[model samples]
Target: MRKIAYSLAMVLLLAACNSESTDKSTAEVQTKQEVVHMEEALLGKWRGMIEIPQSPLEIILNLKELSGSISVPAQGISDFAFESIKYNESDVAITINLGGSLIKIAGKLKNETIEGTFTQNGQSYTITLKAYTETPVTYEKLLIPVAGGELKAALEMPDKGTGELVIIHAGSGPTNKDGNTIGAGSNNSLKMIAENLAEKGIASIRFDKRGIGDNTALIKKEENLTFDLYVEDVKAIVDYAKKDDRFNEIHLLGHSEGALIMTVAAQQNDVASLISIAGIGRPADEVLMEQLSASLPPNLLVESEKALQQLKAGKKVETVSGQLQSLFRPSVQPYMISWLKYDPQHEISNVNVPIIILQGKKDIQVTEKDAENLYAANNHATVHYFDKMNHVLKDVEGDRDQNLASYYNPDLPLTNGLIEEITKFIKQ
Candidate 1:
């Protein structure tokens, strides 16, 4: 009787263990099914608008089963992959690293819509997304070979060929081919210019310089970048355009720092003409010093002036203040030193082609005097001033607050007559 009882207890223990295993397997399958269902609901293209101040910018999110990417058409950003994406049955969180800036989105999945708060650099904005379909691409992507690597560029050709191509170079910093900086949001000024030119039956090419946008891999070290390197890059683009049989006449258009680069590049390349938009006429060091004068304290201002002088002399300062690190950082000092060597006034005078100088009277960064200085230097240059236009080439009729607000407004049209003047210049 004791042996039979022991055998029955063993059998019961085995049955209990098998039952537990079966239950665990069922739970695992159910969990996987729930996850798959959530993914199915979340996958696809989502369209939304970021309710930024004064404007609503459209954004597109494309999700796969496990990964996703985003696009801002206004900013010319496409297929920028997400850094991290965490989602559950009811909620989703996304993080994107733009250069070094962080853009975070937290949303709740409600039926077919995803409503979220888009946060970047401490500013929060509302965004709502629904199912979307992507439009066909209108521009051609080109990789122009440079010294270190190739530049990622876009070519926008008009439907009607005009045999004229304008190469557009953006301003300094991390500004991309679309003229949008990472943290500054999308202004699409350059993109607008390109489209406007295309509408006028002119082809245009814009590019992401080294260490910016898709060309970030071009420069492994910031210290290696120089103003001369920028000029060479522009020359490379010019060379690329020259080789293309589609274009008979090649023109160069540069904004801000790009204006200086094109001025020097035009002297080297066989381009037809050059256009300078809101470019600094004075030495970059002088312009920078003037800009910092109002913002820095007396002591820091003095130090910054000294540092600028050293950089202008082709020397790097060994020690920089904590507050001034962004401007005087050692890695960027070499580029500054090379940039300081060029005087726009002197460089513009050397361009052997017809020159157009366009400036905005309301431009806070560059003054009307800058346009006048360039005109004074170049004998063949014609200058035009937009009375209501700001630095980003937008029409802002109100106070400084309104002027700044236009910088982030992609829908804001370029100042009236701005495109007409450019078209007239190119056609003439």
Candidate 2:
């Protein structure tokens, strides 16, 4: 038997009252311990890879309350459905019967992850599985509407929930709902924030951007996407939360380019508050000039800036130098033109809701000076400069480049006081 009723009640109560203090003390360590679940925490899509000696094998497991499906993408087997799924204590026992052939996997679920031996064809392999914890709240999925179609967002609910809602907008580019992208980059920053907010009894929704991640189909036939479209997408989410009776107030937390979007959206809507993390305080063209100067060679930097100025003057540069083609390429110039119009400080000055500007001192992308400029725009706005925190909101002291390595690390937990500070503000 499992302590279903007891654990559920206790966790919910703890989430409602002592969220920040309790999570600060026990959240990180809990990952190494156990989070016993007697309910449907095990019911969702889980994707991980098995640690083979030479190479890693990818696997996907989709589980319902009692039935499930498993797949080995490399093996050319897709969706081997199974009905014999059993839950016992903290263990998930799955037996897949493929007519004459079978694969048996029994995993121990702990802290939203599963690790166990995978036995198949008289061979055992070590495997670890992490749930697609985007919507870890009631583990609920939120479908948001847009121009032509719907977008997918995950709601990470607080234990008892029924409090405040925060719509998290990730940085620019192709960052997905979980704060990750297609290629080499993987940082679950937004997901971590949602999970952290859950401990503070604050609900949050993070969704994939249009033309990215699962929302790609939403913009399949669309072209020439504008920055205001993103702001509209977020506004739609806020409107959705307004209808739901679970949240008393709605908050916006935006990182990098998202901060600008949230700021513009807040001006048009009645949001409770706004939090800007690693946000730039200048126009997109100015930020790009700074970024290019640091990364590109001196000669190439000059060429990039000259071309950017032309683009900023509402004129298109048909031919870009070879060195700057990757950045000012024709494909992304339309978006850049749309983005360069809004100056951060100017937008921040117009925002109606209270705003908090948070900048990491060690962030190479956006420095503490950016936060200062944002604060300088409105002396009344709250500002926080994290000492050793990086742009990804992780504590990384010493060298700046070495700290950037944490951005690719998916397992690193957020720095201390991040959840604590944000929670205190929203709750207050």
Candidate 3:
């Protein structure tokens, strides 16, 4: 069934985020209902489009619901699905239980037309799905420039309505547009979140990092890049969003390292709002040290301690040998150095814009303590602390190991509460 595959996709997406503390029982506890398949229930083939107001990039969703399966053509990496389809005659509404994610479609259903927002992953999308009579629609990728480099981004917006723009900055690795992962990496986790955000009335812009994808123009060579390069790319995206009339405001939603980028960009630009998802609250150096120390075995931790000493002493870590080399390579060394340079608490404190900080209690990367640190730094910012979310902003059972495993899956959708917090903040 398409629902089964889509469920698998979500499984992969969150697979990597799973670690020793991920818990799946909670998600499985969702209520179940049985319904008879009704031909008049508005089931079958449905057609819809994801529109971006500023650009011509539109994603076509040609979904087919048959028996118990749902197949999506653009299922590139994240296979979206509905576990069960239910219709209510009183309100002319439909409820689609997409895996653990739920979306309620409500609007006038007449002349073979249905319109409403699909609620998923915390955000709401303005959707209009029509019964398909022709071949499924094809999707085309949209390319845009960020930090003077070309980035592949997808957009979804209403034809003429000026909506809010949510620009999703990629996480710490080389990720693509669909959120499907590459290279020791997972699928486009951020992209999956962005697309789900599009289903909710918000337009999202997600792209490959500078040194990755078509963005190579901005990234001279991977070996020579630094943290500031990412900050500049965020600025470029913000600038582009500002010039586009399609959005009334720009929402900078950064995850993990991207959150640091957003913190930097907010200082330099005029952004409508800020959403720091699973971002570090302490200084990068401190967080790195914490993460390394927490994840590494005892022996490796001892060696890492020596490297940290070298770094703190202002000594080049290159002088270190053995396992230290991998920890302090030329490429990663500069980034670590540059990363250690900024104090997130200090930087976020300087941001005058409204900020919403979300952290997953089960996250192995940016822990709930990190979110608290950020919130503490800015006492006035809105903070939503969720106990069930992982670093990728997906709900997880508290088994840390299983949660990290979800990170590699590349099939799961982000946590449901992520977009909801963002939307609630924006609306406020």
Candidate 4:
């Protein structure tokens, strides 16, 4: 009887172990079923915050899973669409082609949460996200009575604490608050500058042109947007800065075309100081001619030479294709032509205020000569040039090809020298 009892006990133990195994298998099968049933609605508008190493920006992904088309909105540019959204279930990957850059996302789904990584320009970053239903939009209409026109302005204060206020005006193109323009092109340099300033307890304000970003309402009326019109806008911001106690002083910092506006605004406003980055000393037309000549290789040098002549003669060159329209547009040409009429050196000479001229030696768009001319014209202005810095104010070196690659890279921080110099000058 004892032997029989022991044998029965061993049999019961084996049955219990099998039952536990079955229960575990059943749980796993249910989990698999739940995962399979969870439809990846990558469709619709997904919104999240992206933290690239250098700075953080808001992201809006308008994705259509079936068509493989996605729209990305960041900075001031909205719904700038891209093609080919490919997915991999095993790696939980999603990728899309953005202009010349490839944007890759590695995502994982757990229960109801979705998280992942995003890589751009050879740099990878962690981006945690969940399925969001609400679409993110960044545009508002505001009235500026001083400017005599209701425009789209970021009326809200900057994320940074107010110490000194820096107002940025974009260059020849429509540098919307987001640093982007349709047809032409936009860079995130302005946004990057704002982020760095925030870290140093400095505040900044940037706006779209009369017609760009939330200002699209104004663009319909073309006559409203003259160079002077833009200057007036800067004045309105400067007035705000002066009246607001948060800003100890207001500094006008312009990039490219905005730089020209700064020279004009500085002459009129009681600005604390002025800074010009990648600004042209000559006219826009002359800069374009010089740029085309410099960008072309030895083999294509002759074609570029003839194209320059056509441009000078007020005729568009057919052979001068491939990114030419981006630099020279009919809408922007008038501004560029008008800009060429005024010399920045003469403008800088008029400013009695202290000035700092920072230029990137490797900036192909605006050469170091442009900065030199401004420095030469102003005997008292402080000048600093970085041989490795590019137009975006990021540290760069080597051939033109490698330098240009930095344009699309979001991971690379803006050159440390630029921030230190500008901050010191503003404080002084």
Number of the predicted model whose lDDT against the real structure is largest: 1
lDDT agreement with native, every candidate: 0.81, 0.73, 0.60, 0.62
TM-score of 4: 0.62
What's the TM-score of every candidate structure?
A: 0.78, 0.69, 0.63, 0.62
- lDDT per residue (tens digit) for residues 94-199 in model 4: 5554433566766665554456777765656666555566524332334554454565555324465656788878776445664544322335677778767777
Off by over 4 Å in 3: 1-149, 158-162, 177-181, 185-188, 294-303, 309-315
Task: Please state the error at residue 298 of candidate 3 in Å.
Answer: 6.0
In order of TM-score, best first, we have: 1, 2, 3, 4
Model 1 pairs in collision: none
Point out where model 2 deviates above 4 Å: 1-138, 221-223
Lowest summed lDDT across 10 adjacent residues in model 4 is found at 25-34
Ranking by lDDT: 1, 2, 4, 3
lDDT of 3 by residue, 234-289 (tens): 77777767777777788888888888888888888888877888888877656667
Pairwise TM-score winner, candidates 2 and 3: 2
